[model samples]
Target: MKGIPMRINVLQHTPNEGPGMIQDWSDKNGYEMFIYHPYQFGYLPTADETDMLVILGGPMSPNDDLPWIKQERELIQELLNQDKPIFGVCYGAQQIVKTMGYQVTKSPAKEVGFAPVYRRDVKFLNIPEELNVLHWHEEMFEVPEQAQLLFSSDKVENQGFILNHRVVGLQFHLEPKEDNVREIVVNDFPYIKGSVLNQTSEEILQTKISDDNKQTLYKLLDYIIEK
Candidate 1:
């Protein structure tokens, strides 16, 4: 690991939604962390300087008319061309798929709340056949060509995918810590209506966090950092 700082660039889409569990893991592992908040801050990190890039979930679509979306998509494509380690969640995953010539459309049913994701292929992931993962997305992205399908849910077929074992696309929120979950319940409750998330904020607080899911996330982060 000499000469490599294990630096991670986090692209945050919303002001309230920042690096959650990823920040904790990075801090504990002594990895350098940089954040790009497109909402408040008007800039994004350069792909060449980033060893690992994490694109956090957002409420916007990948095909939105915003200039930043286009810029981020272009950056994703650039990173893919360079074969850099990339991890994208929710809308970020959608952006990755879009950048790779796949389409991201509205899901037949919105997947929100605690849902079970079954492993399609457990090659790199260290998780069980079925695991409970946090969900908060209305759109789902198609798996790009040549990507390995990893996880899926009853509602969405493409819950997770791997590209050349270096890039990952996750439709669910794997970085939701206790505080992040609470914040989402309090601040984004109004948008949860008519979706699979029909529980109250107090109900969400009582939901248990599976150790398997946590371990899977750690394994993923470790894999990316080691690569």
Candidate 2:
């Protein structure tokens, strides 16, 4: 590990979908954090300014014709060339897959609540066989040509993937606190359609946030940074 504190750069797409426990993790680890709202203003950190890069989830699709979206893709590519540790969630994951020359398509069914993900036998990542995580995404990415599929859920086959062991992308969320969950639930509740895969607002609201998920997120962050 480097003796100096790492400078973590976060690309936040929306106000509601900000990094929850990620901020907590950075604070606890004494890492310097700098978050930028690229959707509002297209100011992303360069590779030199970032020791680690975190891309948070959002409601927008990676295929959308937004300027910041395109910029983010280019930035991901640039960071990959420099071998920076990059972590992405949901739409952010899609962005990474898109940057890797893959398509981000709609899943057979939407996952909108706490769902279980079965871990694959990946040596680099030490995740549990089964974990109930928060999911609120409709579009999903495939495991790229040279990437390892990390987690898969019943509804979504490609729940998570890791590229070159340094770039980690997760479809399900394990970083949201209760308030962060509530914010997304309240802001995007109208889009939730009640189905076997999609949970009702009440069910999501009633389900307490798990501490294990937070710990897993912290572990994943540490793993990515140290790799």
Give lDDT for model 2: 0.87
RMSD of each: 1.7, 1.9
**Per-residue lDDT of 32-140 in model 2, one digit per residue for the tens?**
9999998887798887888999999988999999988888888899999988899999998999999989999988787788878988878555667788888988889
Displacement of the residue 55 alpha carbon in candidate 1, Å: 0.1
RMSD of 2: 1.9
lDDT of 1 by residue, 1-227 (tens): 57766779999987666778888888988889999887566798888788889999988998789888899988888888888888999998899999989999988778778888888966546568888888888899999888889899997898999878788889998788777888887888776778775766677777887767667887777775555
- Clashing residue pairs, candidate 1? none
- Angstrom error of the Cα, residue 167, model 2: value is 0.9
Q: lDDT of each model, Cα atoms only?
A: 0.83, 0.87
**What is the Cα-based lDDT of residue 134 in candidate 2?**
87
Counted clashes in each candidate structure:
0, 0
TM-score of candidate 2 versus the correct structure, residues matched by position: 0.94
